[model samples]
Target: MHILALVLVVLPLAASQLIGGPTTVDVNRDDVQQMASFALTQLNTLLGSQNTLVSVVQAKTQVVAGIKYFLTLDIKNGKETQTCTVTVWSRVWLNDKQVTQHACTSRTKRDGLVGATTSVNVTRTVLKMATYAVTTLNGLQGVHNSLDQVISAKTQVVSGTNYFLKIRMSDGSQTQICDVTIWDQPWSYMTQMTHHSCVNAKRRDIGMPGGLFNADINSPDVKNMTNFALGELNRLQGAQNSIIEVISAKTQVVAGMNYFLKIRMSDGSQTQICDVTIWDQPWTHMTQMTHHSCVNAKRRDIGMSGGMLNADVNSPDVKNMANFALGEINGVQNAQNSMVQIISAKTQVVAGMNYILTMRLKEGDKTQICYVKIWSQPWLHRKEMTEHSCSQVTKRAGGLLGGVTNLNVNSGDIKEVAKFAVREINGIQGAQNSLVKVVKAGYQVVGGFTYVLTLSLKDGDKTQLCEVNVWSPAWTMARRLTDHHCTAQTKRQLAAVTDADVNDHFIQMLAHYAVQTINTLDGTHRAYVELISAKTQVVDGTNYFFKIRVRQGTTTQLCDVTFWRQVWMNSMGHVTEHKCATVRRRNVGGVEPAHLSAPLQQAVSFAEDALNGKMNSMFRFVVEKVENISQKASSATTYSFDLHLVSSTCRNNGNSYGKGITDCTPNYGMLQRMTCEVTVEYRPSSSRKYSLAADKCGQIQLV
Candidate 1:
């Protein structure tokens, strides 16, 4: 009869109850919902008839003497969905359910926070009293605490009235935020400062962390020193690393000037955060790293294994140790030698982040690549620049130039590198493709030598291109492909992506979809035959070049098709045909022929009628592109012509079919872009219709 019974009977009991255990049950389970319903009714009854049951939003069950339901209910309490927490004990078998504790909050009236009513607005009277209380505290503690601002306050009515205040002090640095209490009884003519204390983070310096200060993040001196530290790291660590830009910088003057920098640096292709410290002593011409640590873009440690491991130019240990080393170098040169770049470096942890490096550094206008080694411990505040040798950096061939790049490919070294990469090819992809020749080659020095070779691999009768990077050390004959990508070619080549066969069903489907999408622009219903050939070039995305055979009416023809949709699009069933063409497709479609035959006139008529039927009901339209396909003399498919049709509109056209919309656009939503089709041929007499024309799905003339 009550709302609780109405709710309980409506919900089906779906939760399995286990006896003698507390279980977490889905809140939406029917049994939980049913329990929630009963709990809400009991809550209403226990709390008088004031609060009404809105909905049972959550429930937790404990199997006790019967079942105890910990319920959080959204009640109809005049305001928005205010929450009412209710706990109920139920023995459904005995049909006995009681609202154990209706609120979770005290069910009975209770004084708030030991009988003090809190208020946020600190009146002038409250502040004056708080000041007096603080004064009493200061006199007793032998300190000064002038009031700045009131944070919070509480008032209690006793024989007279008392005020407790929390405030920020204007004078005291450590005890900025403190609590003070004052007893006031004006009728009895009594006033006394009773309490003074501190709470939470504000107990000291208003919750600020120790030894932390804000500094200009874009300080120039900081940048220069930070850059100097990074350059030195690349040297000592033998890393090809460079800074992107500075994020933040701070400086402290101690034994010298210590720079604290946070910056983004590039270690090969990865960009990471480098927290670097560069200690510079210009007066003594000494500069070196104190510390350098790197974290990923997410500000999480990169988990670099410790050792004399190869590190980025931004590695904390490398940077700091190098800074110390550089400072010592400056002291030795006394010529203000500044680091330009690190050519190569190797470091092994000894006392601290220490390094032996070959570096390109600048002394005034002159720069030299030098062999330098340095070691230091920041805690000891000492360093030793052990070795230094230099030669002016010169432009020369056969020298180790930095970075991965395209270089001369006709050299003897190129040939050797190609052969080396080829020798390791069998281990690559474990496929049947054999190397015919190397298409191109580039090299970079990384500990050893790495060659990026674009190879022409032969698989069956197909020739596909595979680009692989092979790493080979100078001495050993062992060479390994670090990375590679090879594609499939019809019967000619097949990519061995982990030993998958060439006749994979997936490959065939892609081949078909790719062909149809290309011809879709021409609107020609050509049946796809066998795949003649298809090859892929790997770049940021794959470029698929396909040679597919398809049927037109009674004759079979070869179409050279190209598509740019992502390769995964085919497998994901989201293939969008971006581009397609017949064999010599580039030359296949172009300008409309010089003369239109009588049949061309009638065929053009049919095409216009079909397209116009699909257009907006209000206005007949003109197609922007007209492709002229005439029966060729030999094996040629069709020649196309691009015709730009001017539209008769008052405003400009930026491809709004969201171009010419409302009642003027095509009926099939917006026929935004039409690449192919609408082949209507009628050859009765020399009937010429001057008004008809189209685009990929454009212009028309009968043949």
Candidate 2:
């Protein structure tokens, strides 16, 4: 069966390179019919075998030309009536190096057991003895050159560690193959193998272990050997479990399987374990472990490579943890407090000298307090005193005593109190060197008051002043005393009139005059006294000089009266000369004679008539009456002596009294009557008075 299998495998390679080779094919008589058909079948079989081998060789040659590894085989078949010869030629290449002309020959004969009627059987065998003899002879010549080439090709290196091995037939045909070997460490080799194994394993058929090969171990079948080897490596490498261990050389602790250990170098430069076996661990630990050194006894958490666990967690000095926490809390509190204080201060209303100040403390609590102090000046009191007698005295003074009130003190009142408080401060008196008294009176009003004094003295001398005044309700007068006699008298007589006596006399005289004046005039009328020089006189012949002002109720009146009796005697040198004249005038009559002459009478009459509203005009009456009357009077005697005398007096006096006289006159008589009219315009008793007078005279009269 093995020989048949070998024959079946080799028969297809006999067509192309071995043109004159023998070929064989198997047949069953039951499936064949006639002799011609049998022969045609054999021929077709032989030709088909050769053509199939040639096709395979052509395909392999195309592959070798295009790619790095390839194999090609050619078969030549020759057939006789009962015998056939087969020649096989093969070409193989590994990574551009090639060996050609490897050949093998075989012979086949018909053989069979007689079946029902005559059956045919075929027998094939490699011509080893004949091929050896041919090979030995070819070796002596260059016919074995291809064999040497094949031997050289087998020893040639192709890939990194792969070599080629060749097998050649005695007919100058060959088959080429590859032998691959990896020189890497078991771990690296296994790691790569593991990846390929996993890929293949995933594609395996059910119940079949991947890469199982049914080839001889001594001469491995290259077609499936690589796959089988990779699977074995995969099993070996994949068996290693990932473990955690400290790598002192790398200053790291790592977790990974053998594959990771094989691929990565433990240089501190690469701190992270990137292997898939260690992928389940935390990344922080992975990195940290890769960098950890044996200098520390314990492994740090995650990325921290140095410092003890207790030191990192418990020591405040390294982190300032307490201060940081406290700072956060204080910052929030301060902000809140600032806001509260701002609102409080903003809401508070201040007036006058008060101010609102906002401040914040440790916490957020807010308080608003107000302060106020009333402002005012101090009041002063004044006083005065006078002496009436040795034991009788009166005093009077005025004062203003007042103080500030309604002071409101609030939470912020300290500054206001300090600013406005009044101590016993110094003060100045209105009048220095003047007798006065002063006292503090303290804060008499709601707030406080200061007092001072104003004093007046009868003698015009006062005492030293003081700061304030003492208030009192009293009246007193200042007094001075002196003594003198009414007349120039001897020293003894003046001495006899003591101060009291002189004072009494003066008082009595003043009282008597006051009484007489008051008795003679009503209260609305003021009384006055005057002392005048003896030479002073009035038109009424009275002389006295002194001016006195008297006030009755609220009215003040000035009056000057010159007494004639006192003044006349002083002028007459004590002679009673005016007594006889006064007596004669009185004895003759109480009325005086008509002293005015004829023209004066006429003028008076005319003035009287005109004043009686007889004339319609102002001065026309003078011309009409006086001129006409004078013209009619022929002789001086015809005019009345009164008229003549009055005219002469008017001429002597040079009086332009026509309007006055005319306004006052009446109808004319023998001597025209002259009139005198006085009009008094009186004001109210409280007002000033005025008067107007009119007199009449003749218009044209001889004098």
Candidate 3:
């Protein structure tokens, strides 16, 4: 089976617990803070709620075509503040930013909070609702860690009663406190366990001590035979029942395998303990419930308005439901977590059936434990994954073999391997190439992770590309540089396209993205000035190498940027390689692009005023080149411009901006002498004016 190489998606929700993800970042940082606030802003716009951001609780970042931020934000909703989670994806290069999966942290706050009572008045009806909540919990989970007496309860009345309770719970031995919330309306026979969280969430396998004679309720085979009998029992009584669990069950080989089971079940209002017998003949595909007994129940005919049936996950209809759940979750979840197996399942009869499935999902080389609730009405061809939650299954540190893997270039592990490769190469005896950063990257999974990378190295005064391969067996904690080679890029070469092709929208887009990535990685802040040339190469995926001109405050620089995209492997393909080194030029001229935006034109006009203000020069600005104008602070902007002249004029006697009238003593305000450069900061909010910052102005006169 060919598995898609694009597995660098969101980690399961559970994995994003107190910490965000493997790539956790500080919540206070400007970028992360911006994302958190933006998520709330988008939430306000989409949900039409003016919930302002209170604080960023946590942040998890994934490096895609842009940065994908998984944020936990605290927001002031109204009277009570709520903690919410959201995903914000941003590709600053393409000028695209979006918010997805914006929601409250807990269902209690997320749903039915509008009219829900703030405090609970424990009336007689409230106690009954608590009992109903426990009954439903016992049905879904089985006898294992069965819910018991409710120590306390908080109720929210939204059409139905919602119970948030701290309950006494125990599997077989130790009792623990479980905070569970459920929605119930006895008249409608609707009881759903909305949220379940425990203080000690981890539990050991409750299988019997090393002995074959002891019954193992956790065994799937035992569950299959037990639930099969339960299904038959429900059908017989004309009653819908939910299984608390198969408390104790063992199989015996006779005419067919005989299953003796002790199960816990609930019928809407009360819980029951049942002893059942079943004959399972796998060869004939037949399973029959022989006899059954329940505590304090003389009548074998109990009628429940509507109830849940403990389902053998392997059964035909139940298996179909599980598959339905998988499809729905994968469709909605940005991370494509495919089903590995149905660990357990239960079906509640509603208009059709509601299947609550606990499944094992495969994400990359890891396994995730998922709980998905699906409502599927096949007759109506309607199905939805109602609720989903998954947590990363921690694997013991050891050998993990995988197939051809196309992973995220920005993954923590991927970058670690790339850095290791650089450390290995730079330390090589008499190595001439001093590598700086990873420009482009790809990887394969063999023993551990095999990283294929293109690196930019500082070779004398020029920037060069180096291809390096590193094999790191993460299990063994070892790294090795298997092979390495370097290439000194000569003058710009258009391999697959002519100079005219550089203007192609597709090419220009890639060029712009590459230049953006370089600016982000480069120490000095810069923006794109010109795309001098671009080359495309066809390989397993497309390879784009571009030579672009960028400026950092009054500094002119040339950078070679390489971008690799395997049909959006992880993002707009990842910025595989980026190299930027300032080119020192004397009397260097500037080139102008075809068009500029309105904001950019306004920025230049402001820049002229600032220049004329700072330097007593009537600056008749020659419109040499206008590259880009990007927002710096909330109200400020950074614009890149090429200067033709900045002659100092002592007075502003009604002289329009950019026009120099009188020559000053050449001693006023710093006359920055550089080849050709200018930086403008526009703050229209605070001071409706621009401040001038220039470089290499006096040395190379703009002709």
TM-score of 1: 0.23
Candidate 3 C-alpha lDDT tens digits along 403-434: 33455766787778776776666555335556
Where model 1 places Cα greater than 4 Å from the true spot, the runs are 1-312, 315-318, 324-336, 342-358, 370-391, 395-410, 419-436, 442-452, 456-491, 494-703
Query: lDDT at 241 for candidate 2?
Result: 23
Quantify all predictions' global Cα lDDT against the true fold.
0.52, 0.22, 0.57
Candidate 2 on 319-352: residue-level lDDT in tens?
Answer: 1222232233345334332111111111111121
Cα misplacement distance, residue 193 of candidate 1 (Å): 41
- Deviation of model 2 at 75, angstroms: 99
TM-score of each: 0.23, 0.11, 0.22
Better of 1 and 3 by lDDT: 3
Q: Model 3 segments beyond 4 Å from truth? A: 1-508, 519-524, 574-579, 585-620, 623-703
**Candidate 1 CA-lDDT value:** 0.52
Q: Which candidate is the best by TM-score?
A: 1
Q: Is candidate 1 or candidate 2 better by lDDT?
A: 1
Q: Evaluated with lDDT, which candidate comes out highest?
A: 3
